[model samples]
Target: MTHFIRVLEFSNKEDALKNFCGSFRSGESDFGIFSVDASTFGSLPSSVFAYWMNPSVGDAFSRFRNFAERGLKAQVGCSTKDDFRFLRLWWELREPSDKWIDLAKGGRYSPFYSDIHLQINWKDNAAELEAAILKKYPYLGDSANWVLHRESDYLKPGITWTRRTKSDFSPRFLPAGCVFSEKGLSAFIDGGSRKDISAALAILSSKPCRSLIEVQLAAADKSQAGGVANSYEVGIIKSTPAPDTDAEVTERLAELACRAWKQKLTLDGIQESSHAFHLPAALRDRLGSFDPPAIEAELARIQAEIDAIAFDLYGFSEEDRAPAQASHAAARTDDEETDADDEGEDEENAALIDQTAGLLSWAVGVAFGHFDWRLATGERAAPPEPAPFDPLPAKSPGMLPDGAAPFHANAGILVDDQGHPHDLARLIEEVLARVEAPVPEDVRRWLQKDFFPFHLQRYSKSRRKAPIYWPLSTTSGSYTLWVYYPSLTSQTLYTAINDFVEPKLKEVGADVTALRNKAAARTRDDEKQFEALQAFELELIELRDTLLKLAPTYKPNHDDGVQISAAPLWPLFRHKPWQKVLKDTWAKLEKGDYDWAHLAMNYWPERVREKCKTDKSLAIAHGLEHLYVEPEAAPKKTRGRKKGE
Candidate 1:
């Protein structure tokens, strides 16, 4: 005895189960079975009589009851014994479609108010059962309708039987060994409409149809059990045949070859290769004698046009230029010519003047020393008391003896009208008469040395020689008089002398009067100018003191090479150019030119005096050494031609 299982189709689980139970109650089955597998009633085995039900039918009943309880006004059946059996059959019946299976898997579907199940029995007459099913339900009788049968029935040989209903049932009509095996005890209830089931069975049994049909059953039992009567129709479909495997592979390989050719064509520089290998016949016919070099020349021409446009936008033009190139060429030419002339003249003149001034300075220094000695000791030595002399008077007509010439006098000095000397005190009285400042001793000495000695020398030189003859006057008998003839005519000499002397006298007298007026005015302007200079001197002293204080801390050797005294003071006053700066700053003072006076005063410390020794410009400007000092001898350098040849 082999144990087996089989699938059965039913209109619904409840209808199928009910039909099975009805057959058993009618004494139409001989299989000994006492229990059924179901969910509505408890599980049972042989000898324990019980009804089975599907769990889905029970769940549907509960849902119906719950909806009713929630005031939905839906119909819910009573749970009596009959109702319980009915639910069990419905649960056992096959569902019209497997769509219920989708519902069981938690997918959405049309609400299934019923459930179905398949029935299994140990042994039964399958042919008899089919006949009995048609007799009980006449819709199963059509040849076009499907009938459930065990596969083993057709496999048996030498057995033939005609189908019949339970009403015509006879023992002679029964097929021998028709009992359902456990493997063949399956049945199908109609799950489609009567008409659709008939058509479906017709199609299934046709020679061209590949599908197999089972059975069709009504859901009328479900309607009585408070379930929907309609059944879900379904078909198990098989797909059409596929192409041969080798043909598919060949097609794919062909496609792959075409794709590879396309990929090769997409590579850079492949066009030239493509043109060489795959030229069309028409293109080859038309391209005779065509030169690619000519095409390249045309492309080069187009590129040149673009380059020209770019150059025009950015490059320089002839108009946009500087004069530097032309000017530099001209300058070079001029420099050559100038340099040729300058070489001879410049060096000689520069050297000759420098040497002559140096010799004169040396002579003047010796003269100053001798004069200083004579002043210190009042002696007549071989030097013959070389006294310091004033500058020459321009009014003087003749030269003095070599020993007595004034220190600054030369033919050049005598020619200048402004260089005439007056009385020293009178000159001062004239110039500063309007000023209340006391005459400084150094200034008086400077004036006397610059002027008085020249005047005396001129007078002495003029009176030296006279006429030896005497002229007798009518009033006296033979009176002898020495006569002096002046260098100029009497009228000229008188006029020149008066002109030289009168203005100076007038200047002195007028200055005294102006002084009285100025004193009367008593403006604080003079005092302020004095005070300003004093303050400026104080500031300079403070600055110098500050530099000295900083000097010890600053090591010029180790630090930046700057000496404090070398720092210029002119910029501190914030004036114009240095010349105007000096003029404006010292103009308010009573001194004729305070700037020069101030410069002279500070002109020489030891270092500066030493520097003045080499600094010709400073020596000339400030009367350093030679300019201020008297010469020991007149310059012996001859100005006149030597003698008659």
Candidate 2:
């Protein structure tokens, strides 16, 4: 380590290594250079040309007792460079399943399994994306392949993670039929056998592996520009300490991981946003009872088992596992205290609290014709089963065909009125009636007070608060019209007015007139009823007028996605945090910041039209390709035959 050697590009690395080792043996350099192949690269990626080699990188590699990076095929995935043009949320596209592959662009921390929300334009082996890259840089010539680095590895089973290690070193298992991203770096072992994969997943998701990876990223960070790394790429991971897992230990770890994965599905299956979601876990078999704490505890128990086996495989002493053990114990204690607080209520009431809520949520989904009624009603023979990495379904099993749901509102508009056939409560009751689950006594009150917030929380995942069922309520929350997000239209408010509000208002008006005509004979109870009906009449009239005023400008476009589409109706959402978010979004929309939205074009046609002429993205978003006016060239001078005449 006395002197350093820096050389120009060599024709052969092997020959260079031979000459370098010979120089040290011949005493030309004081330092002894024994082996100079992968050892020289240290923890640095062999593919990356890093000359800022630190001595500690080499020291980290020496600490790995039995593992080598060569056993795994770790590589970076494709980068579209312009994601907006090529990517869409799976639901955003029509007939998405045939042309689009699930895109694993690493997201929030979800270990073992997570929903892959994005789909790439992989219609013709990424032809569209490749053509775009080539057009952007024509000089790239035949090497445009750099844009899709190691693309041949697409749709292969691997362990994937965000190349930038955040506070949590969460790595998820990526099964076949996905194209990874640069951010979603992946590694696969030879053959990718199920047993080997299970073992790898077990190790990578363990606490010990998480600690090691973080330390490696910290070391790698020092070599980056300004001593901060934007990414924890392949090299840092390859250099992290790994166990030479024994066969028996491998099987045990895989068993625990497999159990943990299924438990995770049970947890996520209740979630409205997860791909694994089918029926809520508690209601999947029957809508009776389930202990949420117990399910969580079982999953935690499995995770602990995985960590224990992984720690032993890594040859860690009792001291090394103590901190993690203590952490798990503390978590368990906290969970026990929380569980004990749940008073011993009867099973039926317990079911009413959340188990029934889940069933009702599913029932509402059925009423809206979004979820499968058969699954909730037990008319369907079997529950939907899902693999960890199956292609996200365009229409999942148990979901009813588009026109088949009996309770689906004709115009996708359901009202709070008790009189209407398409009343939200009436349709939801229809679904609940088909199933044997305990229904809340007053469905209308639940829909008015609890349902939207419950549905909003269920559907809101990551940055998207996309509740498919939206409640557009009156100022006093006296009336509500539920609009299905997928079916919002310029005619929706008109449908609400023509179908529900006017009829209810007319009935209330007749009652008020009758009460006044019999004024002298009216009882004290009759007077109170008349006054209440009068106030209700006023609220209904205001709601109707507001819709009439807003209808001229309101345009609902699903392509704007749920949030932007819901922004214009911000005043309707009650004091929930989502209302504020929608309000801010609306403010931005009015300011011409979101002119790309179809709603924006409807709201401010002239402003969006002008933007469409200059910005192709806006034009594309609005489906107004004609608005992208190409600049006309200047006319050339004739000069009278070049003055020779």
Candidate 3:
């Protein structure tokens, strides 16, 4: 017998099985089918039992056998007597090879010997077989239901058993009915037919029709709640179908479009697409169709009305406007130019006034001094000359002097009308005294003098020297210490001035030298302090920067006079020993101990202090106390247990 079979691949095995089983009963008579088994189904060489049942089914079966021989030798050879026993049904009527060929053609008659070839149609029976399995195994009911339905429609309506000619055997029919007696009975139906076939298949493959007696029995059982039981409950809440009204759908679509537009706009900013898509077509068209000339005319009319109102209120005329506005603008420009010129002149005048004031103040503070000399009687006066480089003569004839004044000379003793000594030594002493303790007025007058003592001496000598005796006085005078001798009075006067002025000049020089040394030491101290303060300030800035970098969210509160708390990872300034040092350093800095603070803090604070002190706003904002660190006590050591214990 020959059977027509259609094979299909489904989205999944369950879908294939559902198609097969759902068409089980109705498919039987239409297709003229008797019984169906896995052995009569289309070949699926991927399954092991199918390959064994239909070894020569098709090209795929031949390939599958070759693959199995090489790959699955252990599984194929391990089969027992029962594995090949499925062929025993027709074993008495046909050889093993003939039965194999028949099964490969979907349970049709073998074509090897064309002895009375009968047409057998088993497509409907195949679906019925799937449904019967699903009835036996409820777990597979849904899947089998679909496969039964699919198979009934895929094959012709009635079962037609036909003969296959010799050499017509193929593997396509092997998968559907192979392994029917063993695993196929429990096997899931593979519902793999297309949609049109699926629903028709379900109606065709329902359970077999029952006799009147069987129907009566089923009715009695149902009345007793035993047969054809309704096990499912109807759901109370019914789902409403989607609205089909055009307006409702249109509103929904508009809402969705708006939401999508907003989402896109938020993500990508306001751009052409967002704006264009957001507007309705009608609005865009209306805007595009607007009349530019008409709008412009309306605008002009409004502007004219405004102009008329302005003219009525302010007495302005269109024709008189231009020249008057220009004149007013020119006047304003001229006024501004004049003001700028005045400002420039004022600046220059102020500068000149400041210069004049400074000059007058300087002039008022200068000092003046005067001197006059007249030589003693019998003393010679000499013209002004450079002083000799020799030491002053000794008091004793042969005693060497300890030190000498290089500029000392035997000049005449002179006096003014007030009896002030006009000797060179006294004059030198007075001049040196003025140099050392120079009043501003005295220094000024001294600076004004032309030849100084030389001019005075010339005047003194001309006034006091007798011409005849002057020559004798110049050559014959013996140097004497006593001023009582008129011949030695000039030598005595010069010597006494040297004696008095030299020591005081030395004293003044020493005082200046000491003052310079003290100043130098103070400067060094100041520099050290400044350097230390600078380093401290730098460290503080670095610490602040580090803190800022670590916690960007931190913001100092100026109103609250306390340092902000630091992040957990950042060590507070107060936690370190350096804190105490900083505090001490800060205190010293406040007290003008710049050097002390610099050394203690190990950084410059002068820069920091100057920055803080000069800016009152900054000083108050960053409280001065924030710069200081509070002292903390050292940790105590724990005592150990006694050695004896």
Best by lDDT: 2
lDDT of 3 by residue, 544-592 (tens): 3443443432322211111111111113232233234335544654454
| Model 2 Cα lDDT, one tens digit per residue, 359-421 | 677777777777776766656554456565555566655455555645464677777777677
CA shift of 224, model 3, Å? 99
* Candidate 3 lDDT trough over 10 residues, lowest sum: 232-241
Off by over 4 Å in 2: 1-60, 63-68, 71-109, 117-157, 162-168, 175-185, 188-198, 218-233, 241-259, 287-353, 396-398, 401-403, 407-410, 426-430, 519-525, 624-645
Query: Is 1 or 2 the stronger prediction by lDDT?
Result: 2
TM-score of each prediction: 0.12, 0.70, 0.11
* Model 3: lDDT of residue 134: 44
TM-score-best of 1 and 3: 1
Worst 10 residues of 1 by lDDT: 102-111
User: Comparing candidate 1 with candidate 3, which one achieves the higher lDDT?
Assistant: 3
Residue 111 error for model 1, in Å? 99
State in Å the error of residue 255, model 1.
99
- Superposed on all Cα atoms, the candidates' RMSDs to the truth, in angstroms, are 65.4, 11.5, 54.0
lDDT of every predicted structure (CA atoms): 0.23, 0.66, 0.24
